[model samples]
Target: MPYKAGHPCFESGCAKIIPHGQKYCDEHKKMHPEEIRNSSTRGYSSRWRRESKIFLKAHPLCAICEKNGRYTKATVVDHIKPHRGDQELFWDRDNWQALCKPCHDRKTWTEDKCPVYHY
Candidate 1:
């Protein structure tokens, strides 16, 4: 019997048919060279990077500086809760704050230093 749409042509397959271009289904179509490489990686994809650039452009001024009445340009997205061991917290959008390069570096350096060992 001929395979129908949403029916797999081969055994152990589960994909719908695409009449035009590639015959592979939606999921299979996404497995193409560019899409395969793009889907294989995780976190902060190129699209995310582009979105960040757009965000910086939209809100050029630092959100913190604005709150403090400083009006400085934003340059970094900082995590409120530092991700020491858990990488998941590293990209928590809700836990992020926008800071200028200077402020972000200062905060990061401060966190890196051993307060107990330093005078």
Candidate 2:
């Protein structure tokens, strides 16, 4: 069987083919240099860890999985909107949602086509 086609580069109008596991093709990946950064440098630091722990405690079930009638434990606190470098949006609790790892990855793959860069 022939291999299935891969996804287009996440960069807008970029026709470069890339694997599902990657966000961008080699050329465009340079434009998204922050993608290679460590989690702590991307605002997932000690403060975020502490706050996300509290968030998960308050909302122990994945919102999407719960909506679909499965009771998955929420381990990730996702920003409903990509906060990018916006400090205000990053800290907005109203823009947050509780999600399991699978649910969070699915949402990111489908919805967050643009990667969020922490400045």
Candidate 3:
């Protein structure tokens, strides 16, 4: 099949066309090297996925929802304390809580101090 030109670089105001199969132009890609690295390194790893699956299997209900008298099924294993990319903290089962997606999102927003929407 003939190669189709990709969309413009994701970086605002960058008109450079990205090569097929690439998300960013060469210049923007270079400008955000840390983002590329963090994308690969940060968040849940394979081990985390395995462990979280086991955890959720054992604890199938949202901890926060339980406290509020709700019975939501847990879908995420959240760290009680912010792991901040620390492997030890990330893997600490004692620091984990099984949370439903809404509870996890609410907890994260509260912990991150994200601005509340008035609507």
Tell how far residue 28 is off in model 3, in angstroms.
Answer: 13
Error of 1 at 92 (Å): 1.6
Per-residue lDDT tens digits of candidate 2, residues 1-119? 87767998888899888876788888887788767566777688899989999999999999999999999999999999988767788889999999999999999999887666555
List runs of model 1 lying over 4 Å from the truth. Answer: 1-48, 114-119
Question: Which sequence of candidate numbers ranks them by TM-score, best first?
Answer: 2, 3, 1
Q: How far in Å is the alpha carbon of 63 misplaced in model 3?
A: 0.2
Q: What is the C-alpha RMSD of each candidate to the true structure, in Å?
A: 15.9, 6.0, 6.7
True-structure Cα RMSD, model 1: 15.9
Writing each residue's lDDT as its tens digit, candidate 1 over 1-119 gives 87544534221265454554344555665444332233215345676577567767766887767888898988877666664434467556676677899888887788744322211
TM-score of each: 0.47, 0.70, 0.63
Off by over 4 Å in 2: 1-30, 116-119
Q: How accurate locally, in lDDT, is each candidate? A: 0.60, 0.87, 0.80
Kindly list the per-residue Cα lDDT of model 3 for residues 12-117, writing each as its tens digit: 8988987777767877787554345643386577877888999999999999999999999999998898765667777889999999999899998889443222
Deviation in angstroms for 68 in model 1? 2.1
